[model samples]
Every structure is written in C-alpha cells, then in structure tokens.
Target chain A: MKAEAFLQCSQCKKILFSVEFEQLLRVCPHCGHHHRLLAKQRITATFDPESFEELDKEISSLDPLEFPDYEEKLEAAQAKNGATDSVISGWAKLDGMKVSAAVADFSFMGGSMGSVAGEKITRTLERAADAHCPAIIFCASGGARMQEGLLSLMQMAKTTAAVQRCRENGVPYISVFTDPTMAGVLASYASIADIILAEPGALIGFAGARVSKQAGVSKAPSDFQTAEWVLQNGMIDKIVHRREMRTTLTNLVKMLSWRLVKHG
Target chain B: MAKTWKEWERPLIEVEENIEKLKQKAKASPEAEREDLLKRVAEFERRRDNYIEVMYSRLGPWEKVLVARADQRPYTLDYINSIFTNFTELEGDRRFGADHAIIGGPAYLDGEPVMVIGHQKGRNITERQYRNFAMAKPEGYRKAIRLMEMADRFGLPLISFVDTPAADPSVESESRGISEAIAASMLKMFELEVPSVSIVIGEGGSGGAIGIACASSVLMLEHAIYSVIPPEGCAAILWRMPDKGAQAATALKLTAAWAKEFGLIDEIVAEPKGGAHRDAIEAAGLAKEAIVRHLKLLKKKSGSKLKQERYEKFRKMGRFLSENPVDALAKTR
Candidate 1:
C-alpha cells in the first residue's frame, strides 16, 4: 500500500510526510508551528463538537471579468476542494458560546478575496448580529480576487461597513491572523479588530518585508513579522496554542455571558 | 637634577605630562602643582555632563523627526503580545494567494478573549520582504474584512494596529483591483458589531491604513505618523519636489501630537526618554496598559451599541466647522 503525501513548507522548503504532518494537523513537526488547513478542517476544529450549522454553502462566483480561463481555474479549484466558492460561512459554538464564522479556503485560487467571499463574509456578519451572537473569522487569503476587478476591491468597504453595523449592535468580533495575511485584507477589517491573535512563526504584515528591503530599510530581526513580533508591537492580544483555542474562547464567552446576564 | 620648564613655555600635552610627574613628585617632594591638575580634571567632568544634558534637552524638530522614524521604536504588536496571551493565527483570503502585509489572529488580553489586527513593518531586509514594507495589497484589506465579520459573530472586541506607508500601487496591484479592496474594507469596518480600537503604532498612510482604522476610539504613538499621504508623496504632488518632504510633513499634521490636537486621534501613547526605540520593552508596556484600559471600557457596551459608536466616530471624522474651500476661493476671486 502506498502512503499519502503531505505538503512542504513554502518558506524553509521542508517536505513533511503525510502521516507525520497529519498527526500534527498539518503543523510542521520540526518547526512546531501550525500550518494552513482546508476551510472544512478549520471549521471543524473551531466550532464546538458537532455544533456547526453551515450557511450559504451554495454561493459561488461567476467570471464577471471574463478573464481567460478564469472559469476553468475556478472549476479546477472547486473540484480539488469540493467547494462552491473560496469562502464558507456558518453558525457554530466556540466554548459553548453561539457565534458565526467565515473561513476562506486558500487552496482555491490562492484564497484570493473576490465578490463571493465578500458577500459571504457580509452575510455572516449580518447573521451574527441578528442572532445576537459573537462573530469569529478565520482569514487566509492572497488578496482581492483579480478576476472580479473593481468588484473584488469594493468588498473592502462593503464588509467594513457590515462589521461597523455589527459593532453598533454590541456584538464581539475577533480576527485571527495566520501566515501571509496581506494587501487589501490588511488594509480593511483585519486591522480593525478589537482583539487580534497570531500563531508562532506565521508571516504577518501589510506589505511584503522584501518591499522594505528594496526601499533601503534595515534588515528584519529574527522573528520579525512572526506572531511574537506582532505581540510585542501591541497589535495582537495574545499568542495561544492551537490546542488551547477552544478553552480560551470558552473563558471569554463565559465572561461576556456574565456581563450580559447582569446587565440585561 | 633637571632644569624645570615654566608653565607658559610648555605645550598642553607636555604640561599635562609634567603635571602628572609633579603629582608623583608631590608624593615624594611636596610639589605645589598637583592640586591644579586635579582641579582641571574635575572642571572637565562637570562641563561634559552639562553639555550632554543641554544637547539632549534642546533637540530640534528635525532631530526629533529622525528619532521618530527610528526603526527600533516599539510598536503595537510588541505591546499587544506582552499584555495578551494565547494567540492563534488564521491566514489567507482563500482566493488568490497569501499576503505578508496584514496580520490578524485570536488572543487574550488580561485574561479576556479578543481578536487583533495590524499592519507590520520589518526590522530587517528579509522581514521587510515578508511584510511588504507594511504596504497592504488588495488581499490584505479583504482579509481584514473577513476577520471583522468573524469578530462580530463571536462577540469579540477588535484591536487594530495601523502602521503602513500606503497600499501597494504596482501595476500588478492595479491590474488586480486595489481601490475596490480598500472600499470594501472601509465599509465592513464601519459595520462591525464589536467594540473596536485603533492605534497608530507607526506610519498610518492613506486609505490603506484608514481602511482598517474605523474604530470606536483611535489612538496613536507619540512618534507615529498618520496621514492621508506620506510626506514624500505629498511633497512630490504639492511641491513637485520630494526634498520638500519636511514642509509637507509639517503641513499635513501627520504626527501623533498634531493628530491629537486636531481631534483626529483619541489619545497619544508616550514613548521612552529618547524614543520608543531606546526602550522598546517599556514602550510596549505603556501601550499595552492603554489598550487594556480602552478595551475594558469598551467591553461594557453591547455589540450593537459599540457598532453605533464606531459608525458615529467615522461619520464625524471630517465634520469640523469650516467654510467650503471652493466657496472661499470663489469669494476671494
């Protein structure tokens, strides 16, 4: 019997065997850091046991830009990931606190943000607000979906406004930064979270660190743009291990629950 | 038996050497010149201390500018990490590819759960490449929108760190659609149903920075610069010369102090004695305290109330008392 193969680290160029990587949940054994997982797996891990109620799972994108072979590319990605669009939105529980979540699947066209992703995120936030539940988003993307043209970029403002409405409704919003969060996503709601978190060794920034090097800036220190660096810079609230996320979130929800009960 | 040179005839070096010799001789022959040498050394020490104190205390604005731009300055990420713990990163927009500009994740502050986001610059070449010099691209903004929406669903407060020159403007970026991404981010941030706070940790430039900066309360580091355009870009556009960046900086009111004075920023986090760079740990500590304090106050409100206040804050950004510039110019004509 042939063993399954695993993906390699895009940075250190280390190839991880399938079994070993899977045991670690795709996290690198050598690095002891988490790696990007499929959107489905992310949802499974983040939500309470058997608590995910998916929404808008059928929404997909069209080739509005008419870019050559764009449809074929989308089709290929969908076939590979078995998803209609790059984003998946749903209702779930984090530590028994009802919440809504939307995750972008990076395997689909490099996880670029497009019209569909924007709509899904907006709808998710709206649902969370309506339900009076907190919202949690797992962002993994390349940037604006180029095939969508200006429509993709417009999602920044549209989603930002959607979240604004959520804020007005007294809902809690949390953003989780992973490796390679950048560009338009950084400019928009990613940087506007009330509490932000990052994983160790994850590359995080708006511009590529190389751009600064090209601009004649000094070299980055070891760990620069890593989760530790962000934490030091006061951009994130904490650096929780992946395994501890559910428990940490539960504690937070419990506190919020107490406050709500007392006030309401 | 040696013939002694008079003090006026001796060179300064010779005089110092002779004084040292005399001091030695005083121990054996009771010489009178020893006291004078000690007095001169004491006077030099006093003068050196005075000069150093005076120079440091009277630094010029230009010099302060240099200090402000120092790369070693402690920023938002440092402070947030220190105060908050147990962070988990979530990556990618799942559409194009991963961008290394913007960072967001889940973390805990003072044992409270929250979500965080920020624009991070690099401390070195490799890191700068990873961070794209903190200039976000379309994906970065989109990712932020995704995160905010999640925060709303989870009832987690949001904290944003603004520190970027601007959005990327490469041909590839334009081809990829930059403006729409920014617009979407602005719209989503305005609608998020969580208490949000923004801190300008370094350079908050243009819509790229503002897209994620729509918060209930916005704060800035003392030396951080927040402006619609970088001084150099402003100079190139207004004066047709990049060398006039200093003038542009002054005119733009980009500094934290200026923004505070203009009511564009809610507060200014203080830096260390020489600047944040000189004492990053201390600087981060101070910023963390401020963030915690703000977050605590915000947690008191319901998600809906937080959203309302956040919307009102953005709505009031440019609502100062002033006549229309076009009308004033017409009247002058």
Candidate 2:
C-alpha cells in the first residue's frame, strides 16, 4: 500500500500533496486558507536562501516552577520537533535587506512563550539593535506557557521592554501576526510594532473564543477576532497574503531603514 | 472570593466574638464586675492586634495570595478617594461604549494634576457582576488608552491601581479586540512623556494587570500578589488539578517581597496590620506617600528621558546565570 504522502486542509478539507503544499507555502490552493507553518518553514519562506544566521541556539526553558511532567514534555517536544523551543530567533535577509528575524513554531507546544522563548526573542532584538539593523518577528502562539507559571508570563513584559529599546534606538521592529496570536503575546510585544501586519483570517484576540462564549459576556459580530475584522476595526496595519508577505515586508524595510539612515 | 476572614482566622475572630459576648454579659452584670470585664476585653483586643502583626510578618506565599484577593481589601477607588483630591472622572473609549471595569480620569495627586486609571472590583455580588469582577473588557483598555493619550497631551503624571484576576475572558471582550486594545495601551504608556507610576493594590493577574502597570515606578502593597496568571489557573495547567494552587502560588513568588527582591517592582508599600483590609486609610496613606516620592523623582526628568528610563528599567528584569551553558550546547549536539 502507498504511504499517505498527502494531507488534508483543516479549514477547506481539500486533500493536497505535501510537496505541492510546501511549494505553495502551506496556503490552501482551492480555498486560499492560510495554514500554520513550522518555524523553519516560516523562516525559509520569509527570508532569502542561506541568509539566516541563528542566534541563542543554546537557550532552552528550565523547569523554574518544577512542574510535574514539564521537563519530560520539553524533551519530547525537542525530539519530535527538532527545535530547541517554540521560537527560532536569528538574523536573516528579506529581499537582500538585512533584518533580525524570529519566527514561532506552532508545532512546538502550541508555540507558547516561556522564559527561554521570550529571552531568545529579546536577545534577537538586542542583537539587531547592536548590529544596527531592523527587526521583524512572526508571532504564532497560544499565549504564555502555563507550566512555567508567572515566569512564563513575565515574558510579556520582557519582550515589550525589548521592543521599547528597539523603538528608543530608532530601530524598525515589524511584527507579523499569523494563524493564532492571542493572550500575552498579543497583549505585549507582538501588538506594539512600528508596523503591525496579519495574515488572512488569523485568530487574533486576548481571550479564547470558547472561554468567552462559556462566560455569557455579550454578543460579538460574526467575524469577531478574525484578522479582517480586526483590520476593519483599525487595530492592524494591513492584511498580506502568504505569497506577497516577503515582498511587502521587504518594501516596508526599505522605507523604514531610510528613516534610520537619515536620523543616524 | 467572599469576606471569609472570620472563618480563616478562627482563633483571632473567636477572641473578638468572645469579647462581644462578654460586653453583653457586662451590660447585665453588676456595676462592680463591669469594670474588670471591660479591662479584660481591652487586653484581648491588644493581643489580637499583636497576633495580626506577627502573622502578617510571617505569612506564607499562599496566604499572601489570599490576602491579595480578599474582597474587603481597599480597591482602586478606595485608594483614589484617600490619595487624590478633586478627581474628575472621564469615561468611554470614544470609539465604543463605556466599560465600567476600569475607571480613569484627570485628578490631583498631592495637589499636582495627574491622570489616574485602575481596575475596580465591587463590594457585593451585584456590583461584582456589574463591574465584571474587576476584569477589564476591550473597551476598558481602550478607555485607558484614550486617557493615557490625554495625559500625555497635558503632561499630567499617570497613576494606575491594579487589582484583577485577569482581563475579562468573555467572548464579547475578544470580539471587540481586547488584545489590540491592551497592546495599544502599553504602547501608548511607553510613548507618554509624562511621569507614570503603578500601584498593585490587590490581585495583579496577567496581561490585564500589566496593561496598566507598565510604569517608571511600579509599587505593590505588602500583601498584594502580582502574577502572569492566577495560581489556580497555573495549578490547573501544571498539576492538572485545581487543588495544587497553594503550591503553584509559592512557586510563582507572587508576593510583594519576592517581586521587590527580584526587581520586578520598585517598592513595597506597607499594609496595616492584618493586611490592607484591616486598615484602608493607613494603606492608602502609605500608597500616597510612595507615589508622591516616586513622582517627585520622575518629575525631574524630561519626557524623552522618562520614556527611555522606563524602557531600560523593564529591560533589566529577569536576568539569570545558568549553572551550565555547556549542557545546553551539548543537548543540541
């Protein structure tokens, strides 16, 4: 029997070959629905070939809380995902424009931001500032990691402070919100960018839809928390398709980089 | 979530109850014995007060969390009433309707004009339901952003009181873009050139707490607990059970003492004996003094300098030295 080399889209349920899906950058060909990608996939699709120089590859989360099964989970995630943690921070070139980049991998523990993930992202920005280059980060997460407890939550402040330094130094920090950006990530650094961009139909919010619905708070519009809905409400700058993302970011970097040059 | 201090402090409360019983007995007893009974009651009261002082000094981390979440504790408004004068409350996000969870407006702190914002929990079930139990909605944060921007325009010092379990995790808040609203508030806060200070009066839970807490000087009440998520939530996630909250609370180090030692907060305001609920006026006084002192220091700096300092201050948090960096590198190999 032939192995199942094809996968089905979660949204449209269209069966497509894995190689074809990879070539399309994981966006559904039939329905145009954007699928969440791994950290490496995001980096490869977003940056020029071999231009990425990874940073802080040695950092991983410690069980500061000594939470049961947490270390085991981290080890299992490392073995399964072939990555250190949820986020991949590095320096990469977008259309030949040098910029520091950090892409979150959703497959790694739902891309939760713990202390290490937060530190890596912060260090990336710090390195970017020292190197005098703009920084861009792709945020795809289910908020703060609960196992790390408050230590995980502090990342929100840590990353936000890092963003603050980038701005103070007149560095352009662009945030690209993809798929599932919610809770602590959205509330802090990911939300405060020089330019905020989102992919089509991303679930972007502070609270989960299910939790909110269970509480019986109030009725929201049908399109609530969707990228388009947030864009209409004027929270994000624009909605870029997966195909046009790299070029659009490249153009933005060129324009913002000039401001840094003129002022410097 | 209720005012259960009587039950929680059985020994002390029982003594107070005994004093009440004795006072009634004295009213009916002969005049000769009344004086002696009254003296006994006074002594008992003194001992109880001392006990409270001792207990407060040695409170466990979990016990502190309980004190931080006590309903009777002074909330944002209570401090505002005692600390500020001539408060003119301004409401609404302008783009949306008003959110009652967060209250903000222009006010005078120590005779100096300032903008005040805070999470306000209610005193009763009805009020809690109305205030969303101090968990802010999207509109609440948007309202905060509007006020922060206004404060920046007028160069008014911004003061915020934090007290909440978390931002309202209601569907309506998410639907209205709660995350974006919080983000906008944080960005606006860091951008503001005016002096900013935050006081954690009670439960400082998660992004809802930090939304209004990104300040140059963040102060927490002695009994207050500030965490990324409530201990119960942390326990449920980590232990896969709700009963392990006490353990989770200890591990999180949510107490003011730990926060100050770790440099997460600038200062720890002393609460009156038996916690802030025992004496709201004294707690408010301490908070006012701390705020005034920080504001004085902050006022000396330029707006650009203030922003830069606040950024640098937060950037310095959570520094650690790994016992073995080689182990981490070897793992990747």
Candidate 3:
C-alpha cells in the first residue's frame, strides 16, 4: 500500500490528509477548533495577495543586559522563524482595506515582547496614527520578555502611549487575541481597542491560570480563560471563526472606512 | 520589635543585637563596668555602621529583592501618613466593587493640592488580607482610573507610588477585565494634562506596576527593584527551576541603578544603608523631596506640554532602535 501523509487534529484528534488540513487553514472541520497559525500563515490569511510590504525588516534585538543564552536563543529563533523578533508588522491591505497590521508569533520565545518587538508594535501604531489608517493587531504573547527585564516591562507603557496617540488621531484600533495572551501584553495594548476579537478557544487573560490558582485568587471552572469566558466577562466584542475571519474583517472595513475607502 | 534578617545580613544583625544588649547593661551597671560597657557599645555601634556601609553597598541582586519585599518595609499608608497632610482616601470603582489593593484620592503634598495613588501593602495580617497583599484587581485599577480623571479635571499634580508583585491573577480578576482596566489606567496616565511623577518605593513587578507608573518623571528608591516578572517567576520560566531565583535576579538587572542607567527611570532616590524599611520616616522624607523636586520642575510646563513629554518619556525607553526615529517610522518597501 502507498504511504499517505495524514495529520491528527490537535483538539478533536480526527485524522485527515495533511494537505487538505493546510488548505482548510489548519482548522478542524469537525469541531471548528482553530489551530495556532505562524506569522507567515497569519499574514497570508489576513492580508491581500502580494499586499504585505514589510517594515523594520533590518531591526533586531541587541541583548542589552547581555543575558545568558539569550543571544543564542535569539539567533536560533531568527534562523527558524526567518524573522528578527517575535512580532512582524507593516503597512498592508487587510481585506481590501488599507491598514497597519502587527502580528505576534508564538513560535519565537513564546512571542514575548522584548525591546525590538515592542519597537515594532510601537511603530505600527505610530504609523497608523500618523496616516490616519486603522490599526489591526493580532496579539499572542507570554507577556514581557524576562531576558530584557525592566526594558521589556517599559514596553507596556510605551505601547499604551502609542495607543493613546492612535486614538487621538481619530482612527479605529482593532485587536485580535490569539492563543495564550496573558500578563504584560494583556494588561496593556491588547485589551484596549475599538473592536476586540478572538479566535475560538484562545486562552486570554491578565494572569496565568496556574499562577492565579496558586495565588488562591481564582476558583474558576474549566472554561475560565477561554474566549467564551472572555466574551462573558465583557472584554471582547466578537469571536470569529478562522474561515470567516476574512469575511468578518471585510464587513468591518467596509463599514468603518465607508467615508475614506475609495469605491470603484 | 522582632525583626527578620536575610542570611547575608546575619553578621550585621548580630553586631546590632549586641549594641542593643550592651546599651541595656550600660544603663544600670556600676560606674566602672558601666563605663566599659558604654565603650564597648560605642565600638559596636561604629562596627555596625561600618558593616552597614560595606554589606549594603555590596548587596547581591537576590538580597535587594528580599529587601524590596521586606516585612517591615514602609507601605503606601505609611508614606501617605508621613508625607502628606489632611489626606482623604477615595475608594471603590463604583462600577463594580472596591479593592483595597490600590488607594488614592486628593491629598495635601507639602500643603499643595495633589492627587496621590499607591499600592498599599498591609502592615499586619488583617491589613494584608484587606489589601490583597497589594496585588490589584481590575476594580483597583478602575478606581485609579476614576481618581486620575478627577486629578486632570481638578488640575492636581498626580503622584503615584508603585509597590506590587503584579496585578491580581485570578478568575474573578480576569472575569472583570483586569487587563483592560490596567491598560486603561496606563492610557489614562498618558492622556493626563497635569504634571505627574511615579516613585517605585518597592517591588514594581510586571505590567501591574507600569499601569500607573507612567509619568513625566519615574523615580525609584535605591534598593527597590522593578522587572517584567518577579525573580522567582523568571527563574521558573527561564531556568526551568524555581530555586534559581538568585541567578535570575542577577540576570534580570532589576535594580534601581539598572533602571536609571537604562534611562527607563528618571532618577534613583537614595535609600538608607539598611533600605527604606529600616527608617520609613527618612524614606518618606526622601520620597517627598524627590516628588516636590520633580513636580516643581514639571509644573513649569504647560498641561499639553506635560502630556506630550510624558508620552515621549515612555516612547523613548528601551534599547532597541532598529533605525533612527524618523527612518523607523518611514515608508515601508
């Protein structure tokens, strides 16, 4: 018998052809659980074809404190992810709408916000604010990078300040929370937005489940930090499925940019 | 009063204890022995000072963390009682419930009207429970937001004291949108037109600290430590072992000196040799001096200018500049 490449869904454990699963955007057809996407895959999913023009491609971290094994890890992540940092952002056309989009990749150091990643996120907001374009961000992070210490912590303030400027410029800011958005990033820019959306089953909260459990603050049920729980908590506006994400965003862009979006 | 001492501070504590013991004996002994006891007491005092100077100057990163979280450390209420007058605390988020983890309201700082906010670590068990060990929930931050808005409306200079392990990490906190509350608090600080200063009196842990610590001038006391995560948390994540907290503390560079050198903080207010916990009166005085100085300097600027400067202050923080300011935001290819 000929060998066939197959994959098991992470959530549903259903076997399927690998190529078909990739074509379906890695979402399980049976259960509709959206798997985590890489930055490249996310860009392809969100932006128009050939519309992604990279920004700050040359910017990378300097290992400021000379933290042990950090430089090596950065190098390894760079080599594997083909990016300088955890976040990849730029001016792009999202569902035919002009926008500045920044996406965090959990593959790189758990998508932690170090100085470089922060600078990229800041520039994304700054650019959006200055251009009066909508800022759309896909946030996936383990909060601030411990390797960068206080510098990483300061990014929360920096990004929040950027968000302030973006809001003052009178443009909408949209945030999409992905899997495991917790701690510093959650406590800052990820939570404040014009419209907040999340993928199905994403673990989104300010503090970690284990940490909260250990701290004796949360005697939560099994579905505590899930997107449904976040929705129930009134933190997010909507939960969009993977296949319908582009359509939902298109409708939003059409409504928001009705005045500015040049009609053909 | 009973005191807790770290392992590294054993020798200094021993000498100090001896000074206390001999001083007791010197007060009641016969003339001859009293004189000798007095001389020995003086010698011990001198040695104690010497030990303090040397040991404190050479405090390891872990020791600083320990000191920053010392049981006797001056809590927010202590500083408020010592530094401000006619203080009236405004509590409750109004939207939900009250959180004693954070407390603030309009107060008289040096006889001038100013809004003061701080993380209140409890002095006793009851207070600690009341304060949630200074770990703020969403409502705590929301309360801060309300007070800050009032400060802007009333044209009061805002002063915030940062002292927290982190924001409360719990089911209830998350359910109430703790993340959004904190982010809103930070954004509110940036939006404030009034001159402001934030002083890190102790542990400025993670985003919880920065939620209110964004100001025109961010100051930290000499021994206070601020970081993205607590040392123990960092050790567990980075080294895969919680016992490697000492090593993680060293690597994190969370000291006030590091913050100053990195330009993340404006100044490092000097603490006494034994840290601010030893003499909270002096600590509050030093904090008052720094606050008055920064507020005076900031008050000269127009409200709009203060807001702009505050935005730039945080915007300019960090070691990463992939390109120059203009080029980084320049056109992307």
Best by lDDT: 3
Highest TM-score model number = 3
Candidate 2 CAPRI assessment class = acceptable
Segments of candidate 3 deviating more than 4 angstroms: A1-4, A259-264, B1-8, B321-333
lDDT of 2 by residue, A68-171 (tens): 67889989999999998999998899877789899998899989998778888888888777777899999999998877666666677778777767877778
lDDT of 3 by residue, A1-264 (tens): 454699788888999887888889988888888888999899898789989888877777878889999999999998988888999999889766788989999999999998888888999999988887888899999888888989898888999999998888877788899997878898888888888999999999777888877775448788988999889878899999888887787778667756444532
Q: Cα deviation of B119 in candidate 3 (Å)?
A: 0.3
lDDT, candidate 2, B85-201, per-residue tens: 999889878887888899999988767799999999998999998898998888899899999999999989999999998988776666566776776777777788999999999
Q: Measured with DockQ on alpha carbons, how good is candidate 1?
A: 0.05
The superposed Cα distance between candidate 2 and the true structure at residue A5, in angstroms, equals 3.2
Worst 10 residues of 1 chain B by lDDT: B1-10
DockQ of every candidate structure? 0.05, 0.46, 0.75
The whole-model lDDT of each prediction reads: 0.67, 0.84, 0.86
- Of models 1 and 2, which has the larger TM-score? 2
DockQ of candidate 3 (2 decimals): 0.75
